[model samples]
Target: MKSLQLLLGLSRGQHGVSQSLAIDGVWGATSSNALASFRQGMGIAEQGLLAPADVTLDALRAGLPDGVPAALLWAVMINGSAARIEAFHQPLLAALERYGIDTPLRIAHFLAQVAHESGCLRYTEEIANGQAYEGRKDLGNLQPGDGVRFKGRGLIQLTGRANYRAYGQHCQRDFEADDPAQVSHEPALAVDVAGWFWWRNGLNEWADQDDLRQVTRRINGGYNGLDDRAFYLARARWLLRG
Candidate 1:
């Protein structure tokens, strides 16, 4: 419950938290309803009861979309020190702001993606090299769907060889798909790559559509058939409203 509260950024005394969760079908007064809602939110089976291995802190910290990456999650799991993960994220927040993605929804979603991708900095080794530069730099692949290397990188997980070629054109860098080292090694390049993907992909357009789920699916792929999409949308709605 405490972790959920933090994930939702809700205060303990806040009544609207329940309302918000209930309204979005994330939580319910009835156990069955609550379980169904959570499952629906996560695009999983709604068992109507919290499973022993449910999201809890570990799962939430490492699942995809909003969950943290496996590496950083492991660190937290072993050390029980989430502070290290938090510390690595400070710069990422600034990077998002610097790239012109200022909305709270965009920021939160961006953070969520980053948390899932970079292991919240738990995988610094990935950054130091280009192996994980899939979406880290502004350099793109040859073109959309180009079968090259070092594709989508950074927070967006930009993949495919063509993506890297295109990113290179946008950033005016002669990027090589085989050389992810260049992309991941430099944080500036990584953030720029992510920003460029966000701008180039239908993300900006969907964001303008004012449909949170639509935008999230557009950015993260329509995985889970947009089941967890509602949560992303709900968060976006709140952030946009603010």
Candidate 2:
């Protein structure tokens, strides 16, 4: 772990690339400060941690998989093999780190819910035509065709114009003006949008307490796919918690 931190120019003081300051892998105050700097530079929260998969060890721009190899996100399933990690990986991990989805349980639940919503990232847009949501005032579908225009997209599937608008406001992106399609097209935004939802709703609290039921209820609006979600959560725990 120190080797990795060193390789990324984050060893104590100048020890990483300078023999003059070389102190092996002794992570003192200097090391923690450097680590915090790296996290901030990566657009992650300025928290000093070393979880090997969250904000702490995730900024491996020097080429350590953005998240761990297994946590790069299951992008697609071809012949039962999920790929797309190679093509679309960094954003998911970076967003997880940036949005305070920092703990093992938090990361596990976050990925599990997104995996289920996106079919393990195989599909970005919802399969339905969204006709059923037409003129649904509750979703801010006040305008004609708003349902089809603002259908579910992104990692956790940001649905409706109101949600898009709200998320855009939080991120200062003007999503509704630019169009919700941007969320589907941009993997980083898609991932960040989901992170935004998760953090804003404080779902991390549920994850930390091991309340998968509440997490599911908040994300899915009820126990729509409890078994599948549980399955994914268990899979996440196997790779991470184990």
Candidate 3:
């Protein structure tokens, strides 16, 4: 299948294979050799055939390019949906690149916070009703329904009318006035907003310092879910290590 071939091709360098396998969805000798090489590297039996239920597919999914592997994401967020993982793959990568989360430490810290905030990319918008934030002048919910209209959305849960307006202004998208829900509806926007928040708050500096507590404080304004955030941070660091 094309998926297997693509994984194998992406993994060639890591597995000590030089030949490129055509990702044409064909089962051929070249593909077989590549798979065998990958299997040998993984300490698995060098079976030429690609089995439907083989663990090799999972291993190959973690191969290279090394931003945030889907396999590692799945591992860290054990309850994450595979469909969501697949959908947010490219968007998350792009957001990280755009926001200068280029190193393993930065990516790990960023992902740890977002993972804790978004429940491992499961819920983009906050589950609770926005009534609690009603009439909260600090959050710029001055109007009758500004709270519900601009409830927290995105991976980092961009909340409040002021925050939305700020992000909309930066991106030239009027999310505060029109289409506020689009932040949660679009994967790219959801992830990008997190990147925007990270960049604006200079959390990457704290991340670079390896100060998990400061990073949490910067994003969360407190130590809420500090334990869970630390758990994800450790997992990401281990998985993202080169």
Candidate 4:
């Protein structure tokens, strides 16, 4: 029943219609009306049955574009700028494909984290000054200004001098030595760093198991802003699922 509601919601979203069902596992007038509307839109005969046929469900799933759609990205990042959405769209898709975040579940998890960490794609760098990290050897903030120099950047907020050096090495760019700020400045690099972190942490395995808590812990090093993360996760799942 929830699956039906999700499909209906997806159909509505794809058509630029903002109406959405609650996706609860209960049959009600709203669900009936949504189903009827969907059938009408698809040029199918409307039926009074609460449960739709397998063929109808298959039809609904058919032709869903591979990877996340821009409409869905806008939906998930509700407060995000349209220009930013346009800017990140192709870069995000490329990163997803390159990192093998191709499955619906993986995409959901990845987008949810990105949405939260980036504040719906608004922030590329951490807002706070990096003074607290001045002597944090764990992050390899080994120099006098290492903390302020490599605080956090990129979509997933990659932090620390060590991390910058390592990711720079991976990309063959001197992020640490030359300019660490480029991680957030370059759209493709901003998204790619997140993909690299995802792959490095083996997050796909946890996403495959649908373990949101574990994924959050891995990404955040704890459960900060956990509810917001879950909210985005639910939204991404609804938007991405067939």
Candidate 5:
């Protein structure tokens, strides 16, 4: 984590980096002063410490939250580049701009959701088998006449036969339920589904309220629960404010 932070800091220049090595621990006076200086430069309230309320830089660049340094996005993207983070990022911003995601909180929500879904593009199903990229599973057929299997695909791990079908129906597109052979696969489709879910289910309201639980449930379904919800919310907030 320190290595990551250091590298990110170097990339973002001194102003772009936070002086605190650990976000979880209490800070010494020196660290506090440094953080305060950082906040002052960014025009954030100088709390003299890292707090959940601290502004994130990414949020500022995307016109998200105020007082967040712009360097944070460069840091995350630099750290998580191998997976083509930009692929999701570029499209997401464009989509948000086109589809009424104008607020800082809204952009933060989607970016954070992407972070939770695939660790900010650090992992994609394609890293496994390209065929596994579409949310299929190899259920191991019992006989010749039995059905074939598939594995989860894309970011957010869109899983199950039913989910694929439902996604297709909702999006009004014929999403193939087979394997990775489809670059016609349109993996970006998964994000579209996510955006739709956010819009239709009122998840967009969670951002304004800062209600992590409600937001997680809407995006990640039953699995996020309390712990993961907190984790994601914090990450999202930090990323946006970075």
Candidate 6:
């Protein structure tokens, strides 16, 4: 109990006098606040005591997606912390579901691909400054700086001007025509954009068939990180279906 509290950053050590004054295994107010706060955070009742199942320690420790215990999301983001994971868990699920990634298999596949592409959501835009894509006519970079201007954004890195314009039209809103940087600025939009890309590209069918190579090719436009995508797919499959 003490270890858990400490790990969760609910510590009384800052108050040297109060820290040492424990009436037993408990530290009075510190213990009370920590326990209560954790309970609420996990969506459990505010009651002081809860059974193991009710509290969902296993589900949480396993990093289960909220409301859908049957589906487990990958928590091992390369650059994601516990706070980061918790913040986007429910919202990610919602966006995925809204974009036709409703099945456990589809959901897991979507999460894995996004995780790999965004480097676990730590990066929403490409890191290479769009220099390599300069003058790439196929990407609709006709202008001098269209490459940097239309650089990839969102979890799936929606690169290329043509792609942005098309996706925006598909959603019946102006992203590329109006503001191409909105996805970079808004976190929620970044998530939804990724879901939209998946839904639009028909990747769900490949996920259903467990054809990871095809899914990777579609998302990445080639076999850039086939092994890593495969690894994430396997992990997501276990977490969601196992």
| lDDT of model number 2 | 0.69
My TM-score estimates for the predictions, one after another, are 0.46, 0.68, 0.75, 0.77, 0.53, 0.67
Candidate 2 residue spans exceeding 4 A from truth: 1-67, 70-82
All models: lDDT?
0.47, 0.69, 0.82, 0.82, 0.49, 0.67
Instruction: Tell me which residue pairs clash in candidate 2.
Output: none
**What's the ranking of the predictions by lDDT, best on top?**
3, 4, 2, 6, 5, 1
lDDT of 5 by residue, 151-197 (tens): 44445554444555565687665545444323114546545655655
Tens-place lDDT digits, model 3, residues 101-204: 99999988998898899998998899988888889899898989888888999999898899899999999999855889999999999999999999999988
lDDT of 1 by residue, 26-144 (tens): 44354333334444555564353445576533333333233233222322222223554444444454555656666645654554444444554444233333344444334443343
Candidate 6, 46-131: lDDT as tens digits? 46543655543443344433334311332334335445566567768678768878776887678778878987777788887887
Instruction: Show where candidate 1 strays beyond 4 Å.
Output: 1-91, 116-148, 208-210, 225-241
lDDT of 4 by residue, 1-242 (tens): 65465566667755333466774557798887877776666676747754445455555667355567775677767667768888999999999999999898999999999999999888888999888889889999998998999988889988899999899888899976688888889899999999999999999999999998999999999999889988988877766772
lDDT of 2 at 79: 12
Better of 1 and 6 by TM-score: 6
Please tell me which predicted candidate would have the highest TM-score against the true structure: 4
lDDT of 3: 0.82
By TM-score, is 3 or 5 better?
3
Candidate 6 has a TM-score of: 0.67
lDDT score, candidate 5: 0.49
When summed lDDT is taken over every stretch of 10 residues in candidate 6, the lowest stretch is 10-19
Off by over 4 Å in 3: 1-65
RMSD of candidates 1 onward, in order: 12.1, 12.2, 6.6, 6.4, 8.0, 9.0
